[model samples]
Target chain A: MYRQDEVKEASFFDTGEGLVFSYGPQHPGTGHFRLIVRVIGDTVLSAEPDPGFVHRGEEKLCEYKTWITNIPHLERPAILDAAGMLYPYCLAVEKLMGVEPPLRARYIRPIVAELNRIGSHFYYFALYGVFLGLTTPFMWAFGDREFVVDLVQFIGGQRITHSYFVPGGVRNDVPKRVPSGLVKQFRAWYRDATGRSPSSDELTDDFQKYVLRVMEFLDARLDHYWDLMLNNALFMDRTVNVGKLTAEEAAKLGVVGVTLRATGIKRDVRIDEPYDAYGEFKFDVPVRTEGDSYARAVVAFEEMRQSIRIITQAVEGLPDGPVKNKQHPVNIRVPAGEAIARAEAAHGESVYYVRSDGTDRPYRVRMLTASFRNLIVIPYLSRGAKLAEIPAIYWSQNVWPVEWDR
Target chain B: MSESKIGYIVNELKQALGESIKEVKIDKKMTKITVEKDALVRAASVLKGLGFDHVKGVTGIDLIALKPPEDSFEVMYHAGSYSVQELANIIVTIATRIPRNNPEVPSLTSIWPSCEYHERETYEMFGIIFSGHPNLKRLLLPEWWSDAPPLRKDYRPPGR
Candidate 1:
């Protein structure tokens, strides 16, 4: 609620117990962004994330580019979840133009969207594993992600920035063999990886082996990132109860995705709104009422499971039809109007508002990304959290800074 | 609400604000209303009474080609109601044209607090001042940015 200009005295705090530290922009573990943290007595007092270091003026850039050209630009915000980011923009444009995508196209859109969701969630799980001091899980998650990326490359000719979703339908149909092939590959991979449940001893041994190997790797490359980073007893002590955003506080701030689901709000725009063939699929929206860092992590894990279920159902009901609408490309002229489209991105509910003046280009394009909305909760949540726990809290929130700054 | 009901809502909004309601267009996609520059606050007030509580987004577009002699800027306030859900999900965008020389419009932040950031963004990108806004500083632009409004048609980036 405080104005940026009114806030003064930006400095790290040491609460007479210990030295306060600042980690960001230059820190490898801090992701591709910067944040200033205030710590006192090995506990974080406040943390302010400084975004926009990578802002490329995408929104303003969209104004000049053709409607078709902006698709690639939009995907850069959250490349891992490209479909979820761009589908809403396509929907908004289609809505403004009064053009209904063919039924076949709608079904295909969701299929690709679910595939992207799986890829994105896997990537998140991989990053989360790395953040939580687990290396094997990170390698496993990322290695599995390559399978989905292969599918995307086969379908869209690009791994990360897939500009497949256009105004009326997808850019092209899903490759005939890729869907079944990927499903089989994923099943095999999962079966071979987590199939046989390990005993407690085996699990402990695996954990220790991963810790040692990861420690060696980190020790050789990045000294700052040690096995003790997130696993240290003091680290857990610092993060356990800090940044506690109850369900009420989370809802009040309109936090979404893992942040809101962590608070036990059974709301997923895909399930609730049921856009792009989601209505026919069966899935559950994960919810945890605790609204803590652990709760957020649990929610993300549960949601990943739910997303896997959705992908399974989508593959099972994969209808045989042309994925792209057959209409002539140049003949498409959206009627003069406006439309708002929302989709459940990996971060949260990402909304796109498109205003069309019956032209090939949009008159106005406004995107309310989930990270931007979730960023508001940082100031509120960081009020009492210890400094040492800042990274854990931030990672648990699952924020993508590019999406916020964009 | 039926199409007729939506029409009635638009007509009622027009009646509430006489000359302020410059243009009212109801299309298949959305219902749009353009108010006079000075009447934006009143138009927003009237729309709120009609059940548009949430300000979905405050969008601005550069219309150099469509600029009139007196006004060269256009701004829109898109608002809707989530309570009514289906029947009332219709968004009514109140657009207004302001003089490019001194583009200024009454801030709706007093009415919709969420519009605070959105308006600040518009001010940063379009250089449209939202008079009476509680905090009018730039939201996305750096404090030392010297570039013209980035979203404007004539403001070209250095290399571009």
Candidate 2:
């Protein structure tokens, strides 16, 4: 039996010139993360983000795996939004191979991608809800997010780390679940919406209509989210002015995704550098200038709404064609080239730099994920802010330490 | 064709830097600008001046084979823009090569503050020291980790 007397105890009373405190390496609020903070009373003087607790040497290991096998490995770091993390990799590999994914694959890709985006945002929202001590929001967000999970599994064949994406296009086509007449109507609506919708003559299938229903359900859920969580005065007070970041600060710090959008910087990789159905979809890049914790939360909420719109448009505009190019899924051989590809992931921009050596294996794979890029701002924000507000600011950024450590 | 955005940038760089720009390769969406290590600071500054502000990541690639008689290491600085709408569409990777034996280069933290963490990462990952960095310490690895920089091509993990 382990001896209780052998355990060392920490004393909070023993304070001297900037007492060093360990925030977490293992705490519910902080999942596998630590902040070595030098604090003077309630305010933090300096915060050093000590990450890599979950470092599995993803980059080094990527050099060994085949281009096809690497998708699952790369997707593991970011479990919440597998498509967002994997999309850039597939795009870069495709670019290297000099083959274009077919039209149907392009349209279908965004449907799953947008659903993953919504899922990632909902996961963050649930965590934010818990971090703020509101159990109701946590439960609600988690439950609602599962609808997206179920939908993706229906099409993708796996709920997490789908590995559904290949170099040329998606690994599998969407399963048929819709009638030809309704799909035609949806296709017409989609063409009207985007103006350049390619003829998916292969016929719109069952999955498109099924996802449309899911989108409608989520659209209604967003209104309820506002009422239960966003509109609450207590929740608003905790986040309104906490951990304020200016637009300039966001720009200089390489901030992307929701955090950048919250600072009134209309930077979204989907629109700025469109990939896989984004160019075909018409949607507004939501921006809020508050540049505070509350603003980031609001931006995330609005982004979910926008993602719903994107999915709805994509499903309605379901085109017919192959979901993949004429490349082998498992035995893909990319030509020698290097490409930097980025996608608008839920948290931020997920960037991948792939250097292929005309083989199944890559020479190097560098994933400068949004969470990793956003690592610099922790010290900047936490330096003078109150300790209690750290969780709100940190969670609002939607940064996953697992992804950061990767 | 006159020049793509990438080619235009490469031409401007070649003109701006007489001999310091060692080589330049323009990929699809990204441009690889290789500069002499001594001129990295100036090149980074010029890129910053051209609206490539934030350093996305600083990666150290070791090309030296086993038993280290060897070649050179390349330090790639991934830079992109946010404020500059036109420039944001392009990713310019400034790759500078240094002798593997003396893997040292001037830090770009002075030009772009965002490179601080990345510089520290490069420092710890490949043992490539960055000169003039404010606080350069172990980032991902534990403080007591006593192994060769794990990402190096020649580095062999225990029992491998």
Give lDDT: candidate 1, residue A317.
Answer: 65
lDDT of 1 by residue, B40-69 (tens): 888787776765655656778777743232
Interface RMSD of each: 3.5, 6.4
Residues A1-406, model 2: lDDT tens digits: 0112311121232245777878788864745989998766777766788998888888888877888888888988888789888988888887887888888888888888888899988888788989989878788888778778877887888886788888787888888774456456555544443444534543336575557755766786778789878899989988999878898988788887778889998988888888877898889889999899889989999988889989888878888877887766578788776888888877788888888767778878888888888877777777667778888878888898988778
Candidate 1: residue pairs that collide: A25-A34, A43-A386, A43-A387, A44-A386, A44-A387
True contacts kept of 2: 0.64
Please report, as a residue range, the 10-residue window in candidate 2 chain B with the lowest summed lDDT. Answer: B61-70
Cα lDDT of model 2 by residue, B7-126, tens digit: 767777777787998887775746788999988888888888888878788777776642333498889998888888887678889999999889899988888888888888889888
Residue ranges of candidate 2 with Cα displaced over 4 Å = A1-16, A28-30, A178-205, B1-4, B65-70, B158-160
Q: Would you estimate the TM-scores of all the predictions?
A: 0.77, 0.90
Give the range of the ten consecutive residues with the poorest summed lDDT in model 1 chain A: A214-223
Instruction: Sum up the clashes in candidate 2.
Output: 5
Total clashing pairs in model 1? 5
